[model samples]
Target: MMTNPTKMERRRALQDSLNDRINFIKSVEEIFNCHMVNFITGNLWDKHIPEPIKEEVAQLGEEKVLELIYHFGSCNSKLEVKMELTAPCPTLSKYLIACRQYYYDMTDPSINDEESIRSEILNDSSTSVSDADDNIKKRNLSSQYLTPAKKRHEVDVMSSFIAKMYEKKLANQGIIGAIVDIGGGKGYLGSALALRYGLRVLGIDVASDVTDAAKSRNDKICRKLSEKCSFYQQKTVFVTPNTDLGNLVKEFQFLWGSVTRVALVGLHTCGNLGASNIELFAATKTTDVPVTILCNVGCCYNLLDEKYLPEGVIDKAHYCLPPLLHGHSVDLPLDETSGFPMSDFLCQRQFWLGRNARNLASQSVERVMSQKKVAVDALFHRAVLQTVLLDYAENCSDTVQKKLLSKLDEMMVVGKGVGRVYKRNASLNLHEYLKTAFEKLDLDIQLPVEEVDKLSERYDCFKSKIKIFYLIRIFLAPVIESIILLDRLLYLLEKGINEAYLVRLFDPLISPRCFALVALK
Candidate 1:
């Protein structure tokens, strides 16, 4: 699309901003993408991001810094107006805030509201999972929803939206089939749709054990809803582009007769699953599967396959997971056809999001801030350990080094590379942490006390240097997410699917990966 910078600049509705998405991305790609490596690699203060940018972010009021990252997205209306760009900011911080300004409010009060959706449906529609059933009324949902209110809220909102969309689709197209929960982990959202909306749902996940677990959980929900309304079923399927679409639909119809339409949905389809779902929905128009709607919330941008660089060409030594997996998709060969930059718009430019940047995109500012303090310098701690390991490999005897460095390339890439995530445990001291880290790695070699002491001394200054830079990265987290979601939205629009929308379906506080890509045909 829409290429006008001035028009894209003015805050507009999500619908209006759809036109300029690719152009805005173009404007910021050079601005933000350059730092993808530095964020992942250690020594960001000196290596990648300019020193001035770090200084500005560190020096600013915490409120201002917090405002830059969290305020401009879909869920909150805390800010009355966009922060002024009149005052100069370091080029990175300024554009990061500005990029967020374009995000369509998730609670966007548009015609797509629930009342409007109800209006589109036929009057006197009667089928339902008895809303007043005492069994359901009496049982506590804490077990099904788990501990948090977030999952409950997400289920309540998403079920209502999916029910509305299905009813609307039924009225407009006369298509009536079950909602196929693609990559439906645990099946809570899909199960709730069936139990609450009286809609049939089939949740497909990858593992048989997961399928078994989903049914085990569904049994808990079904017990409350009464046996008659037990409409949710979980099946295992690795959903690729070439998956048996007609067969899946047949299975849906076979189980429940009079099935003519299917709505594809997912609550949190991680990484490639999310991208692949979009591709499947777009391609299903002419297929035997009479699909009318697609709703998905994608997370784990880090796991999403990036087309810009092939996996082979990229250095594995710069990666974190080897013995442990990054995700299920990594087991499969990298397919440029499946992951990020799905739309041709960015594909033409060969837009690149290095693995580290994509990994950084997965961070939730809300989750991190909830801990009171920045929690732990998990990144800082990991960075220092990686340096020690690298130094050990280089300086130690060949035999000792080989013992420590087995599959080192496949090991966690820490220095001038990336690291694994850790929980905030502020009480940890460097020596204690090193003792525990060595145990986990199972390294028998002894490290010098002097080296450990030197690193301990460096921790204070290193964390300070890295602190502001990390926040800035956290600030850009959603902006990176924006680019990914926008590309998918643009893909739908380009296919001439006019009814699609990027709905901010869940509360960000509870469900951090809250944006759901919803499209109706």
Candidate 2:
């Protein structure tokens, strides 16, 4: 029988695995940049599409490309390559194989293995609570709120895990104290922790409106439980940017009454706020008030400050690491003020991914694949509209062209909002929608019916090319997403915080941005 690895050995193994994956992503940064540049700048319907992509599409033919897209969409995993091809297009088949392999290779094994990580953390040990306590928690959960079922599941799992971590710290450090909820809008999770665990909670947020809402929510909960919990409207930005860490902790201690231990938590803390929480937790250890644990689940990657980027990525144009390393980077030495080289190993190279790419990273592959038909229809609408606008602009005056472009922008926004309606309403005509969009613009000039017909014909001719471009973009999605999640994980690890873990906390189908970065000291 094989011996199980020690905790230290497992940690080293996980780190090594992450480093190897990071290196792999770095190697392919140029290729990803090339693909993104073509997608961003090249016209899909024209000869402006990248030469390599055009050649592959030509080799596969329109029928084959469509077949492959449909086939890939229905399957759960890329490993399901046994589906027989409609046409013997060796070039396209090879390319499809490569795309699947690239996706699986880039994905971190740890993300899908949430159970294993939880097991490792809990050491396969179960904590016993009285029947009364369990019943109270269940009652509070059912009575408490308007959150979706999936969100409730996430909060339940996360809160229980955090409570356990807090108990473990209490046993070790001989300090039992409050849980601090960062960006605690409406105080859902914080209130739950207070009711279920009997732990004092402090919920903080910058938005006064939301903070007010949270206070109202707490009032309702307190009425139900016959107990009060602390919730505050504090500006973390002010605390992080202008104040001294030691002084801030002292201030919190004074207000909260000798808070010697704290468990910092946030659910989907956006952008730099998540990073700020990590910094605050680390800083607390330096002060008399020590933060024993932290559990932060971050979202909105596009909003993260550029300064927090791995040092190597700061200057590069196509800076975003591939999906595998998305939010995490390899360990790099830290600078006290700037948190430079967020990943230690990433200091050797530079890369950049734009806001569009980061937003793309938040998408769920499973959901996208399942909803492929709807997604493709939306893309088709956009592509056809683009062609129509271009043709209309060709014969028009500069003033007319500018007006047409403005109308096109409005139509794009409307299309996104009503995509499902368009899909379901078979009577809704695309040509009619375009005409209505133009009419709504209330331009002085009118587009003739003949012109609309001509534009529709042109779109039909270029439809195949647009579909192929969409497929290629979809294929690259997972790769981009992986890099972002990994980068976030690396940021914590690079700071010498070893207990950090990246977990898929919610169902991706229900919540696309479901990954959570969990840590404890």
Candidate 3:
């Protein structure tokens, strides 16, 4: 018999576990830093960002550039370091604040009452005399810029933050790529991303109404984007809507060539759409595309069965889920509609069990406790009770039955007082007996000995793998969303397109939102 752990022991264990995880994260950060520094020191920026953006990034001196890189690395590693090199700050939010201060110093001289602009620049420099002095200077700067100057500073900082990521690539070329938005309802997110990053977007969805809506929305966006880009060199925003993705992918590959990036921008692509994207990423090719990054925020995982795809393509091995085992011969099951093959006996068993549980609960609740009074709505318990009354009422304890009767007596009085004395044939003891039966039935059915043994063997082998996969699924929303992110990351890895200088505009931790995928390359 194992004893439960003490609170202090559990706490200590948790702390130690956290320390280990943090150390692992630190190692990853160091490895990434070493690789990025070696890569970035070369002409990585030259190949990636624009010349003007490069000049702006160059404005930050060597030490300052390293500081920015370090900050970026920390951010990438999910660390909360905010103070500049001049100060070892404690707070995480302070970093954003410091960046805002850096921008304020750049744009608004009125607020920063330094003796000279040169002095202010020097104070903002990495070579600032002391942390105390820098803090004092920053305080003075903050005191001066109270209103409109502060707003301008914020925008400048944000733009600069975004610009740094694209500094190397944006300078060299206009976006020489296409972004395919899967199930992009009105194509707002994709359209916005394209407009922001200077990429052409193609929104794909099965619904013609949504496609038509996206077309209308894109037309308006084009007019606005055209006006915005008119001052700069010409860049067009094209929106292709209402294309049936079932067969159009091959046609698109033939026409515009394969897009470099595919974005599933949360228009709620359900079951089949996700499975299709996985297939597309594995197969689709384009002339311009070296490899493609897929960014999806998917919903409705339950729907992505064998029926969601074209007939005769999906391999037996590339199952959306794993297959099952049997006594005789393991055979693949065909879908109800498609008559296509799928093999997942375990999954079917699980689904059946869930359905049975719900049905049994409903039926059981209806029986012993006639819908007479409003009391404890213990549906599950009631189901068990009905099962017991039919099967195992003889084994029930008299003490348990008496305990239930007491509640029934009180309910009867209350029911009469409320002008609704609905009487039923079943007594409180019977209800309690039924509840006991239900509990017993659950234990009997849910963890059958053979199933438990099979599960145990699998668990012993793949416990860690199972934990990681479950964590990824549980902590993240809809399966499609995780799939989309993983697809993009895999695409990046496969294409050798690793030097992604990207900024997460939406803070994931704070807002519980995901950042949009913007590929500068």
Give candidates' CA RMSD values in order: 7.1, 8.0, 24.1
TM-score of each: 0.76, 0.72, 0.31
Better of 1 and 3 by lDDT: 1
Q: Report the lDDT of model 3 for residue 332.
A: 39
Residue 16, candidate 2: how far off, in angstroms?
8.4
Give lDDT for model 2.
0.55
- Which consecutive 10 residues in model 1 have the weakest lDDT in total? 129-138
Q: Write the per-residue lDDT of candidate 2 for residues 1-521, one digit (tens) a residue.
A: 54545555544554565565456445434333332222222343343344555665677677777777656655544466644673454555555555555455433344323444565556552332111133223334453364777677667766676666666666346775667787888877777777666665777777778778888877776676666554332333334622243344445555456666667888888766776777776552445556767788777764554444545543233322224323322223333443222444444454345434454555555675667553444455545554444555556786886665544433331222122334354544556656554454564445577876775665565556655665655554565655555555555655666666665556566666666677766
Per-residue lDDT of model 1, residues 108-197, tens digit only: 334123222223332322323122132222223343454367777677777766776776666346766778898777777877777666
> Residue 311 of model 2: what lDDT?
59
Estimate every model's Cα lDDT from 0 to 1: 0.61, 0.55, 0.32
Q: Model 1: how far is 395 from its true place, Å?
A: 0.6
Q: Rank the candidates by lDDT, best first.
A: 1, 2, 3
Residue 17 lDDT in model 2?
Answer: 52
- How many clashes in each structure? 2, 29, 21
